[model samples]
Structures are given as structure tokens and as C-alpha cells.
Target chain A: MAVNDAGAKQVATYWEGMVNSGLADTKAYGTTDFYNGLGSGKYVTYLAAGWGPGYLASVAKTTSGKWRAAPLPQWTAGGNVQGDWGGSSFAVTDQAKNPEVATKVAMDIYGAKNTDAWKIGIDEAYLFPTATPVLESDAFLKKKYDFFGGQTVNDIFVPAYKTISPFSWSPFNSYNFNQLTTGINGAIEKKTSWTAALDTAQANISQYATQQGFKVQ
Target chain B: MTQVETRSATAPAVAGPAPRFKRGREAATGWLFVLPFVILLVAFLLLPMAYAFKLSLYRSTLIEGEHFALFENYTQAFKDPLVRQGVVRVVLFGLVQTPVMIGIALLAALLIDHATSRFSRFFRLAAFVPYAVPVVIGTLMWGFLYSQDTGPLSSILHVDFLSSNVVLASLGNVVTWQWAGYNMIVLYAALQGLPREVYESARIDGAGPSQIAWRIKTPMISSAIILATLFTILGTLQFFTEPLILQPLNPGSITQHYTPNVYAFNQAFSFQQYNYSAAISFLLGAVVFVGSYIFLFATRKRSAL
Candidate 1:
């Protein structure tokens, strides 16, 4: 809920400054040229998800072993701030003919019940399940990817995922994200400062939150 | 809703005061022919429009709950700086982009019509190939060409096409590129329909190809040009696709409320403001309709003129 009040100002300022100083690529990544740019060394690092290896491996075959993973530097040195992406949930639709059976299947597929489902998920797609037991398991920890020179990269991700600062997710995430992007982009264009952008986002999101019938300070 | 019922509903209107018995068969047959289209139109466009209109009159929120808000959403939409900015942008875009596109199409059509070379055939197809490419794909291609790191032509063109200041013109350029060829084909078809005797008469008066093209062919194709202009204006008024496609590439330049259509989508999907979204969409529809109407009415003239 906090925008300008949070360290968002710091994060926004840092990246926005990087872009304005020409220290960052203005071009968006995840494009066709992105992979080629990687091979050409246009990028030194890619801020990718924990499950990025499967996708990265297919596109970045030429630079397979050269890749390395590292934690994002904290704004506050030794700060525990961390986040994740691509979190998903399963649901049984109300219209499902066998809702009860569908529910059980959904629960068991990646739920706490069995290792087989998760084992297949990891082997196939590099899915990072939220199961603490799975995270602590030796097989999960030992699994190595040739892309990162067989580094047990989840060792980096698991701790980071575990200590991800507790926060209530805004129901209006899409609006918040859109405003954030707009602000960040404006800052990148040097039309506004990063802190100014955060301030704008703060006002915009707060107003929008109030409109959605939520009390905001 | 069915054939018999639809025919019955249509019967009184098509019936005449003096000639009811004689023309009833002919009118009934005509109505029957149009029945399928009427059914489809009612099923799709009108019903959805009515529902959206109903939604626009109400407000629904987590705290406020659902209630009749009358014209509150419409009033808000009108006053919304986002909506106003988007409208002003599109109108400006329409004023510039539409004319340029139509002129290019007209010129291209005239030249292709005049040329008697086999290469003209190739040129015609080449011009039309952009039209064949979908808008989404064409914008993507342009996005690549405008990319600083990877675009092949960006440096050579000497324009930072994706920069916020230049992005509207860049979008205009893309739209003009997309539609010019299609409009050219339409105008060319209209040009082809003109009698060859008109050209013969003009040439007999010592009018050269340029004179014939300007004095003879151009005026003759004004109807087609107007039609093309109308379509382009409507297209521009509802401009969404290129901006939507290009937004991610240049998020700094393109905001969520970059265009009215895009704003409606953001409201409905992002903010869960369905009522506001409906209001925005309906207001945009009014703009498109009223804008096109004014153009037509302002330009309305006797066919002979």
C-alpha cells in the first residue's frame, strides 16, 4: 500500500538514474533481440525468475555455462527485502461436473500430499513450489542445472523466497502495477524525478483505492 | 425472433397506405431476405449495447454496493483529464494522419491507374502487402525497426521513433503505412470504373496525363476519397491497436489511459470499474459517431458539384 512512503522511492530513483545515465539498456527485454543481445554481450545480467532456467536454456544455448545467478543488491545493506514472480494457484471451477474429484486432484497435484507431482514439475518445467517441506528436501536442493554450471541455484532462491517480507497484496494490483510502470517510465524519460513519480503513483493509487471502496490513508 | 414473427413485426412498416395489397408480397419478400441480418444485429450489437447502457447508469463498488448513479459516470468520464487528453490526442491525430493517408492513397491510386507497365502490377501488390499484414504484427515490426539496440532502420532514419515526444507521430506514420495501400486499392477500383472515353475526351483537348489525372480522374474519385476519409476518421477516433501494442515497448510514453479505448479496458480489467468502463466506451462511441457525422455533414455537397 505504501508507495512514496516505502523504499520504492529509493528503488525507483536507483533504476531511473541508471536509465537516465545511459547505464541501462533502454530497450525492453524478453524480445527476440534480447536473446541475441545477450550473446552479443549487450546485457551483463538478466533479472529473471527462479524458474527461468528452462526458458533461458532454450533461448540462450550458446551462452549456457557462462550464466550465473546472484541476489539483487538491497537498498539497505543487509536488508532482508525480497520478492518473487509467477506465483500461481489452482482452482476447481464451479461448473466442473465432478467438482469434488477435481478438487482432490487439484489439491494433490502440487499440494502437500505427494512428492511425485512436485518431482515431475521440477524435472519438467523448473516450477518453484511454495511447499516448505519440498524446499528443505535433499532431492530438491541437490537438483542441478547445467545452465548455471550446475550451481544449486535454488539455494540462492529458497532463502530469498523464505524471508520475503510479509505484506498484504492489494486487490487492485493491476492498477498499482500500471501506475508504477507509468511513473517509472516517465522518470526514465527524465520528464519527472523517480521520487516525483513515486509521489504521483502514491496519489493515483490512493485515489483509485478509495474509489474501489477501500479506506486508505 | 423467428421468421414468422419477424415478418409480422415488419409487416406494418413496409405496408403502404394506398398500395398495401399490391406491394405487400414484394415487401414481405424483402423483409424475409433481411431477416437473418436483423436477427444477428439484434443478437450481437444492440443487446450488448443496451446492457452496457444499463451498466453505465449504475455504480458498483466494494463499499458503495450497486446503485443507480444516473449520469454520474458519464459526467466523470467527460471531466476525466485522462479521457479528455486521449480525445484531444485522437482528434489531433485524426486531423493530421487522416489527410496524409488519404492524399498518399489518392496519389498512389492515380499513379498506379495511369501507369501501363508490368512493374505497376508488382508495385500495386507491394503497396498492398502492408495491408495484408495484421495491425498487431505491423506495429510489432515497426517496434523492432524503432528499437534503439536492434532496429535496423532507427539510426538511419535519424528519428527516435519511440521517444515520448515523437511517439504520436510515429504511431501516425505506422497507421498511414498500414491503411494507405488498402485505401489506394479502393480508389483504384473506383478509378477503373470511370469510362475510358473521359480520358480520350480530355486528351483530345490537349490535356496531358498529369492534367487528365488532376482535372479528370481526381475529381471523379472524390466520392471514394470521402468514403476512405470517413473510414479513416472512424478508425482514428477508435484508435487503440497500435498504441496498445506499442505500450509495453514504450511504457514511459504510453500510459494506461493513452487512448479512450485503452482507458475503458484499463477501467474494466485493471480497476474492476465496469460501470465507468461502460460509460467511457459509450462516450467514445458517441465521439466516433458525432465526429464522423460532422465531417459528412460539413462535406455534404451535390454530386454534380
Candidate 2:
């Protein structure tokens, strides 16, 4: 099951592996939908990503099986490249009452010393913490799990955190990004040249930036 | 008898030549009645416009502060290619989207008015439901539907509707979807207001529905159609929300200056070029006013014929 296909391969590989392992009879007890199957009690162990962790945790609790949390699977074992599937941040408004206290609490929860606690809290709250210290700490790093064939999940996060960069947000970021992506995706779906679409997008973005008085490089 | 009549007139006029002061009091009452509206106009509309005009005359950054530059901001705005592009995009949107929207609205109104279809109320309401939805929400929904992976339409059709080459058309589809029904309702009301006797007479004279529609109904409601077209033109010129929402899903296709309003927004907020943004806005307003006047003039000419 190649990840590149992004369709049927993972499911096909799972079923084939189950049959080879004398677990064919167990298939009837589980739904083929992987997302739904994760909730079913048929599987004793499951590997999951950082997204929707809270709902996953609840599902794990409901199933009559033991479950554990781990970092995302790398395309290759110990790969340096990592991607963020989803995450959010918290910021205090200027007009908020007790902003100083709010900032203190935020820093304490998301700051350096309590990295392990933060990770644990995020898992409990069904969120992924963005703090690098928490992601690389001993509590997260030393964990060995049987679900992913005993691969160390913490290794993936350390590399992912190092490779990650902060996203630049602007009022027009959403607007510019949408138009550019829409054009690219449209071209991709239409089986047209993706480069041409991207080129045009670049031109458009530059034109727009210049018009808005942004000194584009 | 003459003496009695003179006395009666004199008695009635005893309060007579009711003071010249009373006329002045009536004039004051008139002013009192209009005072609230006058005060509001000055406070809200006139004050803001004056402030905006003042802002346009200065080179300013929101955070860094402003300095008077006379026409420097306007000059820079005019010189900027991106501003030119924004202006062009808005003009193109108006030219393309306005007629198409109004045409569809007129067609729908005519069909609903003449067709013997059942459940017309249901259709009318369904057509108008898009107007009930907020533009931001509607655009976001359309954005999702335009998504490559999860959108129902994309999945079913197996086409990338948001692609760069086709995005302008895609945007047009969204704007038209939201506005066409609204325009239709306006035109439909106008159609309803047409005297039934005219239609009956035409029918008695053996006139076909198409002839009646083309020759009589359309001509009579030409004013409504023209009004709808003008409204659509103004709305198209100010289009911001749909493109803004769609930009996120596909950044490569849209840019900060895709439309004039967006261009101005980015100028003031993103680039901290408040003066330039102000100038552009004023210029845009002027363009809209002139364009509307031209359209109205043409409409009047047609109506006169």
C-alpha cells in the first residue's frame, strides 16, 4: 500500500495482513471504513495521527479495548521531513479583563518547564501542542508503542518540530492563498499544466501586492 | 345688509392680520421638523466623507502616523500597476457579471410570471433562499464545494472548478447564484404590477405568449429591468466577500488586488498605506458614480424610445 495512491492501498494492505496473520474471521466483526473501524472493539491496537485526538480518545474509551496515543507515522522510518495536518493557537485580546493573568496562564501551559504536562494535557483536551520543548521532552520521546510495530513515535515529532516554520498571517493571506490554490487545483483536476497556473498566480499576487502598496521582492 | 356684512368680516378679522410673527413661527416649526435629519446627515455622512477626503490628501501609515502630501497619494495610486489591475478587475466584473445576472433574473421572472407550473411559491422561495444566507457564509460554503478533495460537486463531477483559468467564471457563478434570485424577485414584483387588462386584450387579439412577453410585457417593465441592472452593476463593482473567501483555498489564483476594495483593504491594513488606500477608495467612488450616470443616461434614452 503506497502512500502516494492515497486511496484503497492502506485498507487493502490492512486486510491482506489480517488474512496472512490468521485474523480473517475477525474482519466480519469490524467495518472496512478505517475511521469507523478505529472506534470498533475488534482491533486491540491502532496507530493514529494528531488530528481530532479528543474524539479519537473518546472512541478509544468507548471500545472494549485498550488504546494508546502516539505521534504521526513518517513516510520513512526516522524521516527528517514532517508536516502539520492541523493546529490552532490562543491569544489574549487587548481589551480582555486580567490580560496579564491570561498571558501568565498561557505561558505556563505552553511554556518550557511543563512540556510533559502540556503534552498530556493536550492529549486529554484533544489538541496538539505547538511548543517544541513539549514535543521533544523525555516523557514524549521515550515512549515505545506496539501499535506501530514498536516504533518510537517521539522521534517523528522531534524532527517535525525542527523542520516546522511559523506561518505568516495577513488579512489578505486567506484571500490570496485561496485564489492561488483554486487556480492550481483547478488546473490539476483538469489535467492542465500546473506550472502555468502557478505562474499566473504569482503574477496576480505580485500585481495585487504592488497595487496594495506592498514592496514586493 | 352691506353694513352687517362689513361688521361680520371685521369680527372675523378681529384676530386679523394675525401677527406677521405667526408666519415666522410656522417657518420655525418646519425647520424643527427637518432638524433631526439635517443633524444626522452632517454628523454621519458629511463628517465621514470630509474626514476621508482629508485622509486621502495625506501620506500616512496607520501605525507610523500621517503627513500631508496633497495629491502625492493619489499620484502614487494612479502610478501603481496593481491599482490599475484592481480597477480593471472591478470594471470587468461589472461589465460581465451585471448583464448576465440581470438577464437571468429577467428570464426567471418572466418564466415564473407566465408559466403554468405548479408550486410556484416553493420555487420562488427556493430561488430566493440564497439571499437569506449571509454573503460570508455563502461564499465559505461555495469555497468548500469548490474544494478539490472533499467537495460534493468536485467529487461527483470530477472537475476542479476553482482552477486559475476557470476561477473568474467560478467566482461569477458564486456571485450570480447569490444575487440572481434577489434580482428576480424585484423583476417578478414589477411583472405582477402590470395591468391584467393589457394582457387580456393582447390575448383577445390572438397574441402569442412570446409576442406578448417580448412586445408588451418586456417594454412595460423596462424600467424595472434597468433598475435591476444598475443595482447589479453597483454590487458587482463592490464584490469582495466571495473572492476573499475563495482566496484561502487557492492563493495562487487570487491576489490582494483582485478587486479594488480588496486592493484598498490590503493597502490600509496589510501594507500600512492608509493614504494610498484612501485615494483609491475615493477614485473608486468617482468611477462608480460616473459609470452609474452613464448607465442611467443610456437607460433613459431607451425608455424615451
Candidate 3:
């Protein structure tokens, strides 16, 4: 039932590790199902099924006290690359009173030296800092704790930051994605044909694009 | 001759002199009293509308080096399918959701007004609590509640109410839930304003509560109902945030062009189709204006008879 390939690999690793460690009785679920199960306290502990700074933070702060964070178990043979789940960027508004000063201050706050602080803040605040230098700092890099069985999350996250793809966010992205997601979910719930849902969604999005004057294929 | 003499005797009294400078001063005082409001109206309301109209006619993408294209945006919007869908969706939404919402509000108002229990005040406040919550927060709360995984309703119903096919209905539910209380308060106020004597006379004639409500109460407060209907219609036409936030739960349920306002927003911000966005906005405004006029005319006709 797992939809994501990377996520399935992660789950397989966790299950295999559990079986080897004589924890075969334990059951595992996808990240989506796991979070849903959290409210009911059905699982002993939940390991995040995917890589992401945001997911890392959530896994680190388990209310059940049984949950912990760890480096995602590898997928490929000798696979070392990590991936991000979600992140956001900051921009200086054109209307800002002092764009240069504002940019400088923003850089300092989000930049490398502040990595540990940002990580700590993110741990506490759930706000991910995107600056690389700060992400690689000792404060972020050397962190070790009982959380995630004492694994250093920064070791994985800081390295993954470099490999992260730069994503462009359009204002239309929120609108377009929303419509698409809603349509998909509706199809799933109603037990309607997926093709029909997709066609409807495509038509809706295309119509939207055309209205917004975007050339659609 | 006698009549003429009498008229002459009263001529000075009949020829009352104009109050001249004092009346002019009183007129000046009246204008002075209204000047602050007039200034504020012009500065805030009138100016922005005029500016929006001007902006709507010209294309000014926030991007630098962009030149103005007059009426080109409007023409392009007319050609956009998304804009057309948004308009169609909103019109349909207004047609479907507004009446249902107002009807529920009216029923609730009547129920609370006629409730024989002492807890009517509590009922009124409980119903109105949704309005007190900010719309964004309220919608978000509903979003979570409609969520397949986390929402309590979904868990209880064992169904994903926020799924794509039914999400519009779900959005309608949230809108109805949030505003029903607000509209109820207005209708209830109108109901209370009805002359007590009419109800008393109805009761003396052995007329039941329903009879009184149907024959007397509703007719007396029809104006309030019409006003609420108009407000709901206008509000539904400008639907945005509910669908926008709800979009996250069901991706394809609402598209960028699901509503006219969202369409205009995406054009301006995403595609940089500023002229098209402007044109769409003016078109939406015009739709609302014409729709309101039609609604007002229909209600006036209904009330006239």
C-alpha cells in the first residue's frame, strides 16, 4: 500500500532491523498512517518513513516518549544520499524600508554561524532554517542525544542540505496543488474512477491555467 | 372690499421674511457635521474603488520594465477558460449554497425565538460561536475535521468527507456552519422586533406556534430575511479562503480557477497576467453589482405584493 518508493525502502529496512533484533512482533505503518495512529497511541514508537528536516524535527519530539529519530535506513546498495521532506525560503520584499540591511540581517539570522541555534530553534519552534553554513555548524553537526537512540541527525541533515533541489514556488502553486489534491482525495473517498477524477482535475487545472493565461499542454 | 381689507390687515404676517443668513448658517453647520464622514468615505472607500477600476483597465505586472496594456487584460480574461469556470462555480455556489444557508439561518432563528425553554440565550450564543472564531481559523478547524486521517468526523463516520468529489459540499457545510449563527442573530433580531400585539392576537384565536410563525412571524420579518439573503448571496459570490485552505486536503477538488477571486489572484501573482487579472476582477465586480441589483429587484417585487 506504500506509494513512495523511497518510503517503502525505509519501511523495509526498519522491519528487517526489527525482525533481526527479535522485535518481529512489532508492526509498522506508513508515515501518513503512523501520524494518524499517533492520536490513538496504537504504535510503541514511530520512525519517520522519509527524509526531511521537518520530519526529523517531528520524530525528535515524540509525545509518547517511546518515539525517536534516526538516519533513514539506506535504500540503494551503499546509498548515502539523504533527502528533504519540506523546507521554505525567505525573500526581501521590494517594499522593505532598507532592502540591503534587511537582506543582511536575514542572512545573519539564517546563515551558517547560526546553524546550531537555528536547529535548536527549529527543534523547539518547528521552523526549518535553509542556510547551509548554519546547518553544517558544530552546534548542528555535533548534536547527540538519547533521541533517535543517540544518532546525530545533523550528520545526515547537514549533508543532505547540499543535495537538496532548489524549488520554485509560484503563487499559483498553492491554488493548483490544492485543486489537484482535493480532486484526488474526492476520487479516493467516493470510490470513483481514478481516470475520471484525473480528467476532471486536469480539465479544472487547465481551465485555471488558461484563465490565468498560462499555456497548457 | 371687506375681504380685501382683511387680507391687507394680515398681509405683513403672511409675508414672512426669509431667515436669510441664519438658515444659511444652519445649512453650513449640517455640512460641517457630515464633512469628516465624507472625507473618510472619499479617502478610503471611494478612492480605492476608483483606483481599482483604473488598475483593472491597465496591465501593471509588479515586475520591473513592464509596460501598461489597456483593456488587453480584460480581453485576455474573456478568453480564459479558468476564469469562465471560476465565474460559473461561484454563480452556482451562490445559487445552491446561499439559499440553503439562509434557509437554515431562518429556521434556527425562528426556533430560538419560539423556544419555550429558558436556555434560548445559551442556544443563541452556542450557535453564534462559529462566527466569533476568525474565518481562517474556523476553516482550518473544519479542514482538520474533514481530514480523512485526523478529523474526528471522518473517524466517526468512517468516511473521508473532505475527499474531492464531496469537498464542495464539505466546503458548503463549513460555510453554513460558520455563518448560520451570524445570520440567525440578524433574523432573530428582526423576529423580536415584530409587534407583540399580533402574536398575542394570534394566540388568543387558539393559533398554534407554527401557525403564528408561518402566517404572522415570517411575513413580519420578510424584510430581514431578504436582507440576509442578499448579504449571503454577495458573500458567497466572493468565496475564496474556504476553498483555498480546503484545497490542501483534496488537491483536485479546487483548482486555481475554482473561484473568480482566486482566478484573479493567480493571474496577477503567478502568471504575471496583471491585465487579465484586472479584467477578471472588474468582471467579478460587475457580476456582483448586477447580481445584487437583480436580487434587490426580485425581493422588492416579492415584498410589494
Candidate 4:
């Protein structure tokens, strides 16, 4: 995504088009209240995390048994691709009285070992485990999501994860996100060319990154 | 030495600056009385301000830890268009909202001060009710009211108050509603302090209520008005809580950079760019100081005229 061959201007132009054509509304998902509208079938499509199915079923019960999982679309049709929305990880602090035990406990919840059990335990909590072995396990594969029209969503997600290009998370991720979102909103509101908006955002983010002691390319 | 000490003690129980021990006890008592407030002010206000100033001079990051950046962060603030835009936005807000709010407050005060004014108590309480509402709750309430999908106001009036085109004005309206009464009270108190004989003399001279309000009463309370305006300007520059609460519900229009305070907050807390955040805050404080000076100067010139 960072090295998009179409160039940054084109990416912005495409986003502007999406906004203009009503393909996407940047304002829609600014908050979790969007789920209320989504549950009532106000939107046809949305980017979802692993727990999205369970969430949709519980919150947007009206759409239950109608939803299904599918591979995220590639930038170019049939191009090898994957993208992630959001995920979380766990860490142990130095202040922990028993670092070894703390590490073990954190791993038991988040690690690949016994992922099937972890997944089942957090079913109501609505989490998708990131364990490869458990994802491919028979128990995990056999379980059905009636809300997602009885599809094995994990199978699709597990394969999708393999195709995703490895990317590094920057220490300045929040600033970057702010710049992009703010720029996009301003552009949308003013009905200006997205290229200008994106260019401004890029310049600001790069400058800020440099000012914050990050190595800027 | 013992004989000299005994003679000195015998000669002066009430002499020699009340004895060193007595002086020390008195000083200790005074310090003890002021200790709590001094500690609180230093801990909560003075120390944090000093820390922020210190942080403003450095650039801290995960890769480099903390490094001396000197005025580089402040320089970046100067160059940043978002910071510039945010300042301009708030200045405009102050320009519009301050006068409008003061005007409404002044009018309400004058009306309430009039002998013929009806429902004075009711009007006074009604005007103040919004001011009593907590800013976050008030903003959130207004957010719901401004909602295009569910808010009754949008459906009834057929207008989206949260739309980018009118959102600033909508915020001005909210601010005016919240502050007009408070300022009204200030002006009202000033008005009450005026000599009754002045109004009587004005009445004798055939000056009508409106004429007296405009010609006599207003000029008399000019100082209070200026004070209120200064407060309003200061308040507007530091605008944060209201817009922040409304931002989540009114996305695309309300960004993290919507206000200078918000921008600084996002930089420090969200981006972990504490140095840059500190720089932004100091710069904002500088702006406020300059703005207040300009305002005071203008008011002084007007009074001279």
C-alpha cells in the first residue's frame, strides 16, 4: 500500500471518487455508533476484523444468517494481496513480581498454543485468535458460523493472512492516521481534489516524523 | 560566655528581635498556615508548566529517546499549516462569538435591570440554565440534536447543524448559549451598582429607558464589558472540551486539529510527540497573551475616544 505503483495522487483521486460515488463515507465509521446503523442494514459492506462476525450477529442481529465471509478484494483483480484492519498484542511489564509466570499467562491467552480452546473461551467476548496451527485444526475448521450463513470464516481469514504483505508498524502510526483522516475529511467537506489533500498530509506527516526524531526517507 | 548569655537573657525577654527562637516559631507557624496551598499550586500548576516548557525544548521518540531539539519543535509549529489553520479558526470564532455573546448578555442585563421588564426572574434563570449544564454533556446533547439521521432538529428544520459548512457557527451558537447568562450576571451586577439618582436624573431629562441603557448605562459598565470580552477571547482560544466531545459523533468536520488545544493533546497523548505537543501549547499561550494585549489596547483606545 505504501509503495502503490499508481502513485499517491492516484490513490487520493481514487479515494475521492469512492467518496463522491458514495462507495465510502469517511464520516460513517468515525465512531462505534456506525454499528447501530449497520445492524439495521443501513450499509451493505464494511471492513471487519476477525471478531466481526460474532459482533455483527450480537449487535446487528437483523443481518444474522445473511452475512458471509470472503477474501478482501485486491487493488487489481486476481492480484496477490491481503490487508488487515486492526489487531492487538500483549506485553509483560518489568514491574511484574513473577515475570516468567506473567509471560506464561499472557502467552496462554494470546499465543498459538491451545488456540482452539482460547477461541472457544473468547467466543462470546468476540475475538479471533491469530494462531496458525489452531486455525488449521479440525475442531476450528469444523465449527460453523450460522450468522455468517454457516461458513467457516476462519478458513478464509487464515488463508488471507498468508497472502498479506508483511509491513512494519511505525512508532508514529497515530500521527500518520490523524493526518490522513483529517486531510480526507477536509478534502471531502471542501470538495477539493484529494491529491492536494494527500500531498499536504504527506508533507505534514513526514515533517512531524522527522521532528519527532524518526528517520524519514 | 555563660555570664554574658545570662545577662543578655535577663536584660531582654522582649528585646533583641523577640529572641531568635520566637522569631523562628512565628515564621514556622506562617509557613504551616500556607503550606497546603503552596504545595498544591506548585505540584499541580507550577511544576507541570515548567515541565511542559522543558519538554518543548526537546524531541523525544522511540528510536532516539530524548534529544535536545532546542527551538526546532517551536519552529515546526510555526511552519505547520494545521496549527496555523487551527489558530485562525479559533480567532475567527472569538471575533464572532465574543461580541455576539457579549451583546446578548448586555441586552439581557439591561432588560432585566428595567423596572418595566416582565418575567425578569424567569428569563434570568432560563438564560442561566444552559450555563449550568456541563460542557461535555451540553456538547453531546447538541451532537444528538445535530444528527442528520436521528436528530429531530435536522428533520424538523431540514438542516444539518453538524455539516462542515455550518458546524463552526453551530458551535458559536452553543458557546453563546452557555456563556451569555454568565456574562449577563457580571454586567447585571455592575448595572445594579449604578446610583439610582443617575437613572432618575436621566428620566427627568426625558431620557427613555433605551436611551439611558445605550447612552448612560453602557458607557458606565464599559470596563465590565471589556473584562468579559477579554475572558471570552481567552476562553475561545483554549476551546477544547466541547468540540472534542462532539467530534466522535460529527466526524469529517471535527478533526484532531480542530482546535489548538486538541491538536496539542493528540500530539502528546495519541502520537507520543510530547515535545511537539508542549511546543504547540506554549505557542498557543503566546498567542493568547498577544491577543489579550491587543484587546486591552483596543478597549483603551475606545475609552479614550
Residue lDDT tens for model 4, B82-186: 899999999899988988999999999999988545689788888889989998888788877777766778778998787788889988888887889999998
Q: lDDT tens digits, residues B104-136, model 2?
A: 988888889997577777788889999999999
Q: Mind giving the per-residue lDDT tens digits that candidate 1 earns over B1-305?
A: 48767766766776656476637766777788899999999999999999999999999987878999999999999889999999998999999999899999999999999996999999999999999999999999998888766788776887778888899998998999999999999999999999999999889999999999999999887888888999999999999999999887777787778889999988898778999999999999998989988888877771222
Model 3, A1-217: lDDT tens digits are 1112455445545554555566542211232434555545554543332244345346435543344555555668777655544446778999999999999988777765655668666566544346655555576566654444566656655555566567665435665555545554554445454445546656766666654456666
Docking class of 2: incorrect
Ranking by DockQ: 1, 4, 3, 2
What is candidate 4's local distance difference test score? 0.80
- TM-score of chain B only, all predictions? 0.90, 0.87, 0.86, 0.88
Candidate 3: clashing residue pairs, number = 25
DockQ of each: 0.58, 0.08, 0.16, 0.42
How much is the lDDT of residue B236 in candidate 3? 90
Per DockQ, the best of the predicted structures is 1
Instruction: Give one clash count per candidate, in the order shown.
Output: 0, 25, 25, 0
- Docking quality class, candidate 1: medium
How do the predictions measure up, each by TM-score? Answer: 0.90, 0.65, 0.69, 0.84
* Model 3, position A182: C-alpha lDDT score: 52
